[model samples]
Target: MRALVTGANGLLGSNLVRELITRGHEARAMVRRTSNVEGLAGLDTSMVYGDVRNIDELTRAAEGCDVIFHTAAVFSYWGYTREVMMETAKGGVTNALDAAKAAGSKRVVLTSSTAVFGGSDGPKVLDEHAALVEVGVPDYFASKAIQERVALEHAAKVGVELVVANPSLFVGSYDYRPSASLATITGYLGDPLKITYPGGVNIIHAGDVAIGHILLAERGEPNEHYVIAAENVTWREVHDTISELCGVPKPRIKVTRTPALAAASLMELAAKITRKAPLATRALAEQTGRYFWYSNAKIARLGFLPRSMRQTLTQTIAWLLVSPHLTNKQRAKLRPHDDVLQAMRQAQVAQRLKSVRIQDLS
Candidate 1:
């Protein structure tokens, strides 16, 4: 199949492009001219420049593609106004569908986030049927919900095939922009004493999420939504895994919900006054102790197989250690001793052996 992936340089998009090539499909990567292409360095795929907001550019880039994977949007929570976020999310999808129709693309795999399923205060497991949590959702997540709604409605009106892939927090290598999940992981890795939040989230490998995207395109039912997720883990568990992998002491400081929200509100106010991004926002603070868990059985039925969280983090750290995207300070903070490196190597080997054994048994 011939495919066009918007935001091709992003964490998920880059991985999706690689997956397409691995499956012997043609991939036309559509990225902004200003986007850093370091992660896509060695891939053999056609490259085109375009913005999802501009219909003409999208139409031109999408020409002759069989499917269009719309994954372009600002993923950051701070530093962007609500108007900008909504427009990019909603308008971007509108333009992508228009372009896809113009380019004769038969299907469009819209990359939406599981944030649209809304967050849970306890250990509730959400599925594709879950409603959007309307109260106090951050603009970033709200925009994603809006983006999916608009894409589905608009696609129906335009007579285009649309399948929504709602992915949870994904971690893996080739994160050139170093997505929000990666940023959070690096922050924990950068400081052993950093405070931990109370909330939990579903985590998956970005590569696995990429494969899910392809499967959605090829086999997913039109107008249906699939939550592609793996393990559901708490923030403390996430921190503990990283600490073990990096040989750092687990964080002793735990920030409860009330204080976290207070700090986030103050940061939001300061960011508005200073026109700078805040370290925490009230939206994130609101989700402090909540659990964002989802069932991936829908996608799993289509043969979606994700690695364990430990294996994902182990590979992530191994890549981050030598990634060109890291600055000098980040490099220094993430640098592990010989013992930690050996531990990671041992873990990788053990995981490989276990996978082989499982396969042999099956």
Candidate 2:
């Protein structure tokens, strides 16, 4: 099969490209002229330069392909206007589908996100049937919801074959540019400071996510969505794991939602002023302020099993240790100072426990 993979330079895209090549399929990678090609090095595939939002460019790139994997998107919670985010996501998906139909592609796999489920409370495990509540969700999540709707609606109208894979936080080796998951982990590594949050996240390995895309293209039902996730863990557990991997002390600070929200808002303001990406944004804080767990039962039923979080983290950390872009000093600087604060908080709690014991004896 001749396959066209959009965003072939990204984390999941690179992995998917490699998988397709290994499986003896003809893979044509669609990348922007300015995209990082370091990930594509040594991979056997043809390349086409174009942006997904450009319909003419995409149509040209889609020529003669049997399948299309639409994996490109602007993934961020801050630093973009709602118009830019939504239009790009929805436009990209629409263009890809149109191009696929014109090129006589058999299937077009759209890479969506588990964020479509939005923020939730408690330990609820969301499946594909979970409805979206757009009231206070982040722009990125909202954009993905729109993207999925557009893809499915277009597929129905055009009689095009389409499938959507909604993956959670992706982690694993070959995270060359570091995703949001890696950024959060690296931040904690720099400070060893305990950061407190109210929510949890389900994580999947990027390689597994790439494989899920293949499976969906081969066997998924048209217009259906599948979640690709492995484990649901809290912020505390996530931070502690990074600290352990980096040999840093864990954070003792247990910050609540109020302070975190305030910090994120202030950061967003500063980012706007500096014309730089915010360390955290109001949208991200709102997301972190609630539990965002999901279940991959649908995909698992299709023989998609992901590696354990321990396995994923271990390999990811090992790769980071030797990464040319991050020197030892540079890596040390990435740890969050919050770890020491968390430790201090733990000490205070221990002291209070001792005091209570003495008072009871009196």
Candidate 3:
């Protein structure tokens, strides 16, 4: 089998490329010129430069590929306007589908997200058949819903086999920059103050999600949607697990929605002033307040079973601890000793001062 993977440098795309190669498939990776290909190191695959929004580029990349895995999208919790989010999700998917059809691809595994389901106040495990709760979903969710609808409709009309995989929050090794979920967990780890949310997310390992895509490509039915989730856990439970694994103190501060929203507002203000991405934003606050539990029974029937959340977190934290990107100053912050924390604080201050100095020079 020949596979063309969009977003080949992203967390899920990188994993999909590796899995396809391991299964003896000729993989072609389509990535932007600026995308980081370090994660793809040592993989036997052809790298093609292309953007998801470019039709000609996508068509060129998809040529002669048997299967197309469309995983490219602008995924972020904050710092994007509604228009930017929608265009990336809907326009990007449309371009991929058109390119795949033009290139004569047999099947396409569209990488969707659980975000399409939206938030529900009622605490029930949402299956693929469950009604979509769209109120208050972020722009990203709205865009995904629109994109998937287009893909499914196109598949039905053209008789092109399309299988949609909706993965929940993913965590595992090779996180590279560490995705939104991993970053959130890392930010909260060992903190004396913790913010608790009424809602939770279904967590899965990135490797499992990647394998699920491969399985769907090989044996999945057309127009079928599979929810790829391992375990549904609350925010508190996730933080506790990370603390336990990392030997860090669990957060004691339990905040409500109002306070969280307020904090996110402040973060957004800071982000604008500093020209940096905010840790929390209005959309994030809205998402955090709603339960996102999902049922994976449909995919499980296809012999898909994922590891426990605890196991996934253990491996993820272990990887971060030894990662070259984690500076010694950051390690000291993780230490239990008070003196270590103070030293880490000083290092952070010095680092900020150095950045300001460099900017002044520039």
Q: Which candidate is the best by TM-score?
A: 1
Q: Give lDDT tens digits, candidate 2, residues 8-107.
A: 8888887898789888887888888877766666666788888998888898888899899999988876657899988999899989988988888988
By summed lDDT, which 10 consecutive residues of candidate 2 come out lowest? 353-362
| lDDT of candidate 3 over 134-154, digit per residue (tens) | 456777777788788888877
User: Ten consecutive residues with minimal summed lDDT in candidate 3?
Assistant: 353-362
Using alpha carbons, what is the TM-score of model 3? 0.88
Per-residue lDDT of model 1, residues 203-293, tens digit only = 8889999999999999999999999999999989988888777667787899998998898889889988999777778878878898999
Better of 2 and 3 by lDDT: 2
TM-score of each: 0.89, 0.88, 0.88
Give lDDT: candidate 1, residue 35: 84
Among residues 3 or more apart in sequence or in different chains, the pairs in candidate 3 whose N, CA or C atoms overlap within 3 Å are: none
Ranking, TM-score, top scorer first: 1, 3, 2
Better of 1 and 3 by TM-score: 1
Judged by TM-score relative to the true structure, which candidate is superior, 2 or 3? 3
